[model samples]
Structures are given as C-alpha cells and as structure tokens.
Target: MAKFDLKGLLNDRSVPDRQQDQKIVYRNPKDLIPSEENFYNTEKLERLKQSIKLLGILQPLLIENRDGKDYVIAGHCRRKCCIDLLNEGNDKFSRVPCVYKTSSELEEDAGQEDDIVRQIMIIQANCYRDKSDWEKMTETLKMENLVKELREKAPMEGKTRDILKDLIGTSSGQLGRYHAISTNLCEQLMSEFEEDRIKISVAYEISKLNKEYQKQACELYEEAGILTLDDIKGLYRQQEAEKGIPGQMTIETATGQNRPPEDDTEIPAETQIERFYESTNKNMKNYIIQEDKNMTIFMLSNLYGTARVRNGHLNYQGTTAGITFNPGRVFEHELSWQSLAKILIGKYGHKKPIKMVSVDIPEKPKKKDNEVSGPAKCITGKSKSGICGAAAYCDTEYNCCAQCPDDCNSRCGWLEERCQPAAEIPDEKQPDFVEEIADHPGEAAALPVMKNNDQRKEWLRNYKLWGLWYEDKNIGVKYYKYDFENGACLIAEEYILPGTEWMPEHETAFLHLVGGPEPECKGGIPKWTYHARYYKFPNSETELVEFLKELQK
Candidate 1:
C-alpha cells in the first residue's frame, strides 16, 4: 500500500504479466553510457531512431539511481539515442517515462545504496533473461573441457572426434569438438561465434591448432581479410601442412601497395580489440555517412522465387572500393531494404561495416602499374554480342553476374537508358540488337514493323489504356492552371527548377524514379505524379495484335 516501493515486486514476478512485471522506455542518447553495455552499431541506432519516431514510447527504461539521478538499469542504449534526438530540437521525446524502482529489495526511493541496487537489478534482469542461451554456451564449453580431459584419458576418441562428426554428421564426438571451439575462442569472439559469425566447425578447427597457431591464423585473416571461423581453421591447417611455406599476411598500406609479412614478423598497425567499448569509440568510426537519396535503383526485377531486387549504385573509388555485393544463393540471413545491404560488400574489403557495411578495396598507386595487389582482373575478353576481345563488361569481380557475356559496369548494353553508371557509351555506338529481334519482352509474341500511321496510332491507344498514360492527350509536362469558376486559364506559380538538370531517367519512361517517398503532386492528373516523360509501356502481344487489328478496321 506504499507509493515508494513500486520496482521491487516486478523484479521476481509471481504472476504472468510482462507489462506489470517490467516497464521499458526509450532513453536519451546523451544520458546513456555506451561503454561495455551493448553493441551499438549504426544499423541498431537507425532502427532505434525509427521505432521511437513512429510509436510513442512503448516502454519505460530501467535505470539505476546514480548520484540522486537515475542511471540506466537496462535499456541505456535507447535512452542515449532519445536524448540525442531531443537535443536536436525534437519535442517528441520529452514524453518518455522511466519506471521508479527502489535500488534495494526492501528500501524507499531515497536510499544511499540506490545506485548499487540499480546496477544489480539490471545485471539480475539480464542474467535471468539470458539464462537459456547462457546455459547453451556454458554447456558447450563444459563439454569441450570434458573432451580435453578425456583426451588425456583416451587418445583414440580425441583424434577421431573431428572426422566422425565432420564427414558423417553423426557423433557425440562432434559435440565435444564443438564444445572445444566454443571454449577456445576468446569470450567476445566466442559470443559472436555462438551468435553465428564464426561457425562451430571452423572454430573447432581453430581450437585444434596450438594456441599460438590460432592467434597467428587470426592475425593473418585480419590482414588478408575477414575469415569465417571455418575459414580461419582452414587457413591454419593449410599453412601447417605446407611445411616450409612459412606464414603470410598481405598488408595494404596508404601507399596502395600490399607487402607480405615475414614468417616471424609482427604487423606494425595491428592491435587486438575484444570488447564492445573499444569497438564503438569515435576514433574507430565514421563521423557521419553523408546521405545521398540519389541511390539510383536501376533494375527492379522480381524473379519468381526471390524478392523484387533493385541494385546498382556507386560509392567513391579511392584506395578502397566500397560496394555492397550479395552473391550467395545457398545461405542468406535476412532480405530487407537495409538488412541485405551488409551481405554485399564483396570480400577483402577493409574497415568494413556490418549491416550497412562499406566495401573496401585498396587503390592501385599509379607507380605500381603492375602491382596486382588483390587479385588480377582479366584485362581483355571477347564480348558475347559477337564483338571480339574487349573486357566483356565484367569489369569488377565481386558483383558481376557470371552468365553476363558483357561488361560488369552498371551501365550494360541493350537496356542502357535506365541504370546509369559513371562510364557510359554514346547512344550512337550502343548495341542495337533489340530492333532486329523478332519478339520483345512485353507481349511474348512478335509484331510487324509499323507499316502504317494507323497502326502506330492504334499501338499508342492500346498503350494509353494499359495505365501507361491517361485517356486524355495529357502527354509531356502538363503546365498552367485552369480556373473553371472564372472560365479562364491562369499562370501556375510552380517552383520549378528552371534548368535542364531536372531530366528524368529515361526518354520512354517519365516521372523518373530518382528515389523514394515521391511527394504527391496536386497539379498533375488529380493526385497523379507529374512525369517528365511518357512511359511507352508495351502491354502485351494481345494488346499489340488487338491494336493492329483496330488499325486495319
């Protein structure tokens, strides 16, 4: 019946109501301490910002009473972000509330040990929530320890333990090996490995090698590039097997040259970081990612099994080239606008990002003409359009479609107008293979060339009916305003950028989808977008044949 001790009862909930059990609130970014609490990547922060904006505070944050003020009990990251947004003049955040909890089990809000209680409360809450996963990781580690103990007691089982589960996929012996890898990796990497960054098999192989060897392999991987836990183990085994091959790590310097490390040498700039605090500091991250809404989505193809994909954008190419490259069919995590972006960075990319990772490729110094730092790009090849020996357009190795016989540059031939890349060919010299073809993509049937004016008119009408254009002849940019009440036309005051820079993406397709959230225009066809050009939509062969038949009639 007291107004003070509200937080204590929720700690160990007897009844089964989560809301009554706990309250969560979005915390301000400034108030929250980002050291050692959680992994606050850019992706996580962006998601936090969006959720806070859309829904009013869904939960109250649990904070400790530190020095008469509440310190974060659990959701410190959210609190910090909210504060950051509020500082930027966002009034929307002032409403978020925090749950008032007594720091001690049986104490009032005004207690000296309140801050200590708050920290314990958070640790206890996290511990309780993490019990299940914690148990799994612990069990895996314990089992691994047992294997090591038993290996001394039984060698036959220990040595054969790897092959039994790896090749056949059926063995308790495999579980022990998994336990060994899970335990062998450093606590931070172990947590990530458990979360799936390093596969168990890969970690197991790493664990099998000597500790010094494992460290060597990890360093080599950092220099060469990110290695999957399995990849790490493979490299270790490979190097060990090669007898006198000696260890190697290809380090890329600011000079844009890759120098291989000697067998017993230490990397000059390499340092070990294994915790959340060290990774999130300003010195280790980008100050700001300049947003370019001009992320041009050239091709939007909805293949039968996959989600509609719209790729093709370019980042600056300096020493390192950052392009999000997703070239996996067998194993994929999440398929979302932002989620899929992290997967496409192609490999050996440095200072790499996770969700919205920046691609990395060292720039070639002009002096190192034949440097060949990473891998050799085939300079010349015969283009498939019957053109002999030219770099078949597959210029880049990471994202190039293997089936494509043309160049890998974003602006490919035949359909060159839409996806515009930096380097483009003149329209005069562009491929003209489409006109000679018997059929086009839209109809699934062939159409004769426009033999008459009537035929062309019929085709145009059919095109209009298929949502490509309006019924009225409202082609091109519709200018001016009609004052129906006054029975007169008036000069429309449009804030039009009076220059040629406003050109659309294609001549055939209008309005030009430069990017998203296109504001609804009132001046056009009653809520319709004011397109810069008319889209020549080929409806179908039936529409085409029907239009031709109408022309004949």
Candidate 2:
C-alpha cells in the first residue's frame, strides 16, 4: 500500500472537504453585550428591522470576546433591530450572524499600545450614519479622553495631538476646542451643550470664565431665556472693569470720573477723579456740554417745580406760582437766576418777596458827534466808490450793504447800526440784568475760561455730565449717554440710587417739563433722554459750567 500523504491530499481539489475556517457564525442575540458608545435612531432602526425581516442580515456584527462574554465592537444598531424582531415573535431573528474576535486577536488587529486606534474604530463605525452635533461632540470628547489616557500611560512624544487630529478627522485647532470642552466644561453645561440647549462656542466661552462667574452666567441664561455672544462679552467686560483691570472698559461718570468697583476701598475719590480727567481730553466737549445742560435741567425741575428756558428766558412754573427771568445774557445769567431762586426758596420758601433792585449798567463808548461816519466813508477809511458802493440799499448786490445809513451801499459798522430798529424795554416784572455768577453760590467769583487750545483740552478732560459720581462725597447721581440714530440723538441716561430713590420722580418732572414724548419704562424706574430740539450745544466752558449750576439747583 502507498503511504498516505495527508497534507497533499488536503490541498488536492479531487478530495471532498468536510470542514474549513469559518468567517461567520450564527449566535443568539441574548449572548451579545451592547456598546455604550452606540447611538440609536428609532426611525433608522425600524427601517433596518424591516430590511432584516425581508432579506436577513447581510452583514455580520463585529464582536469581541472578553472574559467568556461577547461585547459588540460594531453593528450595534443592527443587533438592536434583530433583538426587536425576535421580541415581536419572529423566531428567525433569534440568532444573528456575527464575526467574533478574542481579546488577543483584537489587541493584535489594532496595535496594543495604540488606544487611539480602538477609539478611532468606534468613531469611524458611526461616521457613515447621520448623527446629531450633540452626539458628535460626545464622541469627540470620548476620543479626547482616550488620547489623554494613552498620553499618560505611554508618552506619545507630542504625537498624541496629531493622533487626535487623525482620529477626530479635524484640524489641530478644532481638536483643541474639543479638548477644551471635555476638560473645562462642567457636567451640567456639557449636558446642556449636548442637548443643543447651549451653543458649543458659547459653552466654550463660558468655560473660560471663573467657576463663580460661570454659575452666575448660567443663572442669567435661565432668566434671559438665552445668552447671546455679545451679552456674554459684555458681562466679561463688566467683571474685568470691576476688578480694576487696565485694559477693561469702564463706565464714565458725568463729572469726568470713572465709577470704581464696589470693592475698591483703597482708591480715593480724588485720585479716581484726577486719573479720569488725566486720561480724557476736550475731544468730548460736545458730549460734556450737552450732558451738563441735561443735568441742569434735571436738577432745576426737581428744586423749583417745572423750570425751563423759553424764548431766551428762564421760566419757572411751580406748584405754588409762576416766575420768569429775562436772563439778560441768554445762558449764564439764567443759571444765576436759578441759583438765586434756590437761595430764596431755601431761605424764605415759595412766599419769598420778589423785588427789582436797581443795578448800575456799563456805559457804551460815546461816538464823536463830529465824526463823519456814514456809508460814503467806510469804517476802513476807504471811500464808498472803492468799497462795494451801490446807489441804494439792495439785496441783489452780494457785496452791497443793504442796511447802509448813507445812500451809498458801503460796508460800514455805523451804517449797519443806523439802519437797525431800536431795542424794546425788557419787562420789569421778570428778573433781568442779574450779574454773571458761578455754578454754585460763593464757589468762585468768575467761571474758568478756555481761551487757548491747552485750556480747552483741560476743560474737556475734567468735564462730566451725567452718571453716578461723588458730588461732595456722594453717589446719588448716576447718568449714562447712549448714541442713538447714528449719533443724531444723544440720550442722557439717569438711574436712581438706593439712598436717592426720589431722583427718578424728579427726572419724570423734568421730562414732562421738556414736553416731547413720554419715556418707555420696563420697570418702575424712569429714564430720560433730552431731545436735541430743546437741548442746544453750549459755546464756551463758562456757559457749560453755568448750565451745570442751574441743574444743581
């Protein structure tokens, strides 16, 4: 007999084979353990179950053998559908095709040292499926944690991030953002982010804030129903400003002072005011002048009932009676009358006697009676023929003096004066010709002037209109200016303090006195914005100071 060659016979095609290496095997659904990382879609699972019922499972579930139990490495959704089919009394779904791998085989398939490879497999399995952003973020976080754990067990020599970038299929920058969300964000915020209640970018930004601030921000979110990026940035800025940080934006007070944080006990009011004035310049003169005027009006209405300037005069219509002032010089003298009125009211109440006292007036220079000063002889000593002379007063000639005293239309001051109508006597009943005074009684004899460039800049630096500041060491008056209508409107804002709750009532009286439209208020607090029609720009520092004095009344 010929010796049997078993190896050659097995390889021979003539021999019938009874057994071969099996690539797939049917296993009971109850024996497989579901993966925690898998996300289920109900609609997709139902469609999958229908497909399985019709054609049977075409793909085998990938499972890992760990300690005598089968753990699903992939095909989790398909396994779930098979289990559902069996539960619905389909005995054909009781067992499903599975490709099994032992622990040693799995470790060999993906390098034992490369945990990121395993995580990558898990994430890549779901890549073809439609997953929500929340679900993707959760997977990204898991991958991030795996990378961190791998980094600790065996250092990757800076290749850990590169591995993460590969595993997450994102750039290095985006990988860092995912890592931040995983490491920094609290569990509650993470849940919110995952549920799509909070935006990922917003959650990342919120994570940058301190834990206490984050808690506060969450509370604010609950109250506001939503938190915008700008709102979050504003809160951050406010927090930074409160800490006296150098680069943070601060609230500018009306008196050109910064509203320091509540905890700044070491900072002196004078120092803060001085520093504020030093930083700002007269570039904000227009804003300061307008705010001062608004503050004046706000204060006067409170002290002297309904007070305002009408027809170039200070008009006061109070609860008891009405009084008027000619305000001889228009703006400053009106403030003087306000100061005087306040004095009278404080000293003698509303029944104070109103009397007119005779005051000496400055005499104008007397023109020589023999001076030949008519249009024929121009003020420049030029003859009318040489100085825009016309036959008679006419508006048609651009160079002609229409109101010339003489027949010749020469440009002469005397000619212009002679052609004007005489002035009317001011009403004696109303206060007139009061002396120019300081903003406060006995504060100073003369108002500071800004004649030169340096002086004007200094004035602007020290100027404050509205907002809270120390007024002789008090924090009652708080004001703010908001730009409206592309700078067409400057809104003066005022807030009532704890000790000075009556300030809002006074502000309401001022608003009513100005008489434009009622302010829109959300809470009980009232806000007032002076209309440009009633509030005109002041020309000089003296005018602004006097305006503030009138308001201080």
Candidate 3:
C-alpha cells in the first residue's frame, strides 16, 4: 500500500526568505513535468502550437517547485506546444515564461490536512476543461485509489463517496457507474469502451453478464466485425432463447402439461437438409475444385468406367474381355449425349480425337494461361508417381469407399450418370446443378462463392462473420488474427491500425476460416499456389458450410 507522500511534500512549511513580489522566470519547457490528471488533445495541441508561433506566451505557466524541478499544475498544453516548437529549432520558444510556487505559501494555504487540500487543488485545476466520460472514469479511478490508500492510514466513514462527488463534480449515481466500470469490467472491454468502440450504455449492459458470458459476447463481437447496441440486444435474446425462456409465466401455467405452441418460423427438416446440401456444394466449387482438368476428370471418370484412349478414339472399358465402346454410346440410354458433347467441346476444344493404344494417355501440353495442368497432385504419399490418379478420387485417400464392392464409380454409377459437367452448367443454371447434387445421398457438393455486396452484408449479419486482413510482399506475407471476444489480444500485421473498429472496405480476404470442415483424409488439405498464406481453421465442418454459404450470398 505504498503511495506518493503528497502530505509531506505539500505540508513542508520551512523556507528561505525571498522578495514578496511575484516573479516570472524563463525556463526550458522540457523541464516542466505535465500533470498526470490532465488530458491531452492532439487537435488543441496543434492549434496551441500555431498560436504560440504567431504570438509569444501571453500568460506565464503556473508551476510547483518540487525536488528542484518544475511540475506544471496549469498550462500544461501551452508548455507542450512551446517544447515542440523548440524542438523544431525555433529560438523564440527555447525558454518559456513560468511562475514558481513558494513552499511556505503552499503550506500556509494547505491549512491542517495537506493531502486532502492537495487533491482538491488538482481537481479544481482540471474542472474548467470539458472531459469525456472515459476521461472522467479514469480520473475517478485514480482518486478512488488515492482515497483507498489514505483511508488505510486514517480510517474515514462515508466521506469517500461525498469527497469523490465533490472532486469529480458528478452525482452519486454517475460516480457509481464509473466505480462499477473500473471494478467490474474486464481490462480489455474497458479499453474498448474508452476508445469509443463500445457505447457506455452497451458496456453497462455487458457488465451485467457473467464473466464467461461476457467473454463469449466479446468473441462474438470481434467475429462480427462490429458490435452495436442492437447486436448486444440480439445476443441477450439468443442467450434467452438457448435457455428456452422467451417470456415469464405463472408457476401453475408453467407447470401445466399443455401442447407447446407451434412455431411457424421453424425451418422444415427437408428445407434444412436442402440448404445443407446447397451450402456444401457451394463450398466445393469455391474451395475444393483446384483445376479444370481435375473437375473434368472427376466428371468423366464418374460417368464412365475408367475412360481410355484406344487407337485415337475416346472409349470406355467394357465388362467383357478386349471389348470397348464409345463413352457417348455407353451412357446414351441414360444421358443426353448432345449436352455431354457440348461440355467436352467447351473444355477441350473441338480438336481431332487422339489415337493411343494404352489407357495411359500422354500428359497434355501445358495450358496457355498458366493454369494447373491436371488434377491436384496427391499429397497422401500413396500414389505411385506421386501424382493424383483415378484411385485418389475416393472419399478418402487412405481408404477406398466401403460401399463400393469394386470401385467408387461402379457403386455410385447412378450419381455420375445423373451428374452434369460443372463447365456445362451456365451461371444461371448452377442452382439446378446444386439441387441435383442435393438429390443424391452421398455426393460431395461444392460450396457457393460470395458474389455481391447485398449477399456479403446478409452473410455478415447472419453468421456474425468477420473478414481476415492481409498484406503480401514478394518475400513474405502477413496475416492478422482478430480476436473479437478480447480485442486486446489481436495479433495483426504492422500496417493494420490498432482497435476493434470494423472496416469492411479495408478487409482484403478471408483466411483460416474458423468453423470450416477438416480435410476428409490426411494430406487432403487444400493447397493454393498463389503468393499468399492462410491460417487453418479448427471449427466444425457443418458450421463451416453454413458460414461459407452466407459468405457466398
């Protein structure tokens, strides 16, 4: 409980005799110590600097003589302005006008209790300037700390609250709020509230929640990018909803065995299933498909049993020995060959069919636009050539599909036959393709991509999602880890400004998406060749799909 001895410093009465006239002395501005209770305004400081440049110090600074140095009790800002001007090589500001206080006069003014008098003087000096609520709260906490220390030495009854009210010029109720904020709120939330990122009213409401709930709400706030009063209200509602209590009721009515009211807003089981499938498909399209060749290979291999190049014609292996047929004719009974032909034409172009005896066709020449030549290389460490092949197409690279007696294509033949090439589906016709995938029981669907502003807003609102901030250089790139719950813990790149204020326009891209699915198999993790890095998210796959779907909207 060690504290600075304000009483001893202010109460010392012995002093050498001096002239009675008040004298102004020129002193180095840097020697003046600013008052800790004083708040600095950048704008005002700039204005003050300009004024001093145009006109010399009109009034001398009031400084207390302490330890052979000047402690500025008043005109701190003006002294600061002079100091800055001096630093810029302005000779006119090299020495500032200051009036020093005599120890004998200060002691005489203190009366009996010097510590209380000293506190009153400090408060009175700052009272003329308007202060923000945050600033007031900060000052109040300092006074309370001083009072607590003094009370330990000299026990006082109800004088603490009254003294605080008088010093801060606020009512007991307002002082109570300041005390609660200082005592009850966590350090991080307090900082945010002080920075204007959080409203005082909203902060007070949050202070009411338990520590765990408060932490969770903070997490939600960071994830949502911005947290408003309405957002806080929504969170409270969600918490109540989770507790199954939207309203209060009489004990008899609550205990009575009556059918619960039907909820018209509840999503139907079928609709939820459909949405899940749609979301899953969208995610696949946005993140899973790495190459046009891979998708084409997937579609073709799924449709026809191991496609092979035989004597320059595209054909499918037949069940009988040495027998093969054109893929168009083999699935002609089930599919529209004309649409399939058009997809092939769009993807491979209308080139003359190549002639090859073995199924292993020579690798096609590299694509012109620097696109990936084929399916993603298998990283499972199981492939013979270390390149992904037909075997790598199963649900898991480590194990073959359990449902397939022979191969996945044979078992899931119906899915392949019904599926259309991704390229063939026009932008407007893509929804139908997703519906078709949803109709199937076990097919992996691609997730959607975020396309427009409205969709982005809706997605952000629905999932409370925040975009990742990124900066890339040739040598390396940086990723910012935003912690919504405890903003003080944010790990960001140097370029990002400090604070939790959400700026959607400043968002570069989403990375390390939390609440997304893990790779189905080891080494199945997605890879990007672009000159950028991403963090891995460890959230559930179901939540990831829903999150991505909203992002896609």
The number of the candidate with the highest lDDT is: 3
The lDDT per prediction is 0.36, 0.45, 0.46
Model 1 agreement with the true structure over 1-553: per-residue lDDT tens digits = 3233223333445221343655545444455443243322323466667777777456565555545655555555467667767887887785466664533433343344443334334443443232323333443344344434433432322243443233223367656665676557655456556455555555666776666676776676567655566566566655565444344432233243744332322211111111211333342222211111122111111111232222222111111122111223222222232221122111101221111001112342342322222222111222222221121222333221222345645422443223222133222322233122212112212334667667655544333222211111111221122111211111111112122221222222111111112234345622222222212221223333333443344
- lDDT for 364 (candidate 3): 36
TM-score of every model versus the real structure: 0.27, 0.37, 0.36
Over the stretch 1-553, how does candidate 3's per-residue lDDT look in tens digits? 2333343343342111121245889888887887665553434468668888999897777678767777876677788889889889998887888776554443353345555545545554555556566767776777777667556654444566666665566677877777677677777788788776777777876765667667877897788866677766666655654565646443444686443552323332223222322433442333223324445334443544333322322223422122133334423212232333233333222222111011111243344332222232323333233223332333332221221235545232333333332233323321222232213222122223566555544443333122233323321333334332211111222222222211111212222332222323328643211111122222223433444443333
After superposition, which runs of candidate 3 have C-alpha atoms over 4 Å from their true positions? 1-22, 35-44, 51-59, 102-120, 147-158, 220-225, 237-553
Off by over 4 Å in 2: 1-22, 36-59, 90-92, 101-106, 109-120, 148-158, 220-231, 251-553
- As for TM-score, the candidate ahead, 1 or 3, is 3
lDDT of 3: 0.46
**Pairs with backbone N, CA or C atoms under 3 Å apart (clashes), candidate 2:** 254-464, 254-465, 255-464, 256-464, 296-551, 467-478, 467-479, 468-478, 468-479
Ranked candidates (TM-score, high to low)? 2, 3, 1
Please estimate how well model 1 matches the true structure, expressed as its whole-model Cα lDDT: 0.36
Relative to the unseen true structure, what is the C-alpha lDDT of residue 216 in candidate 3, on a scale of 0 to 100?
Answer: 76
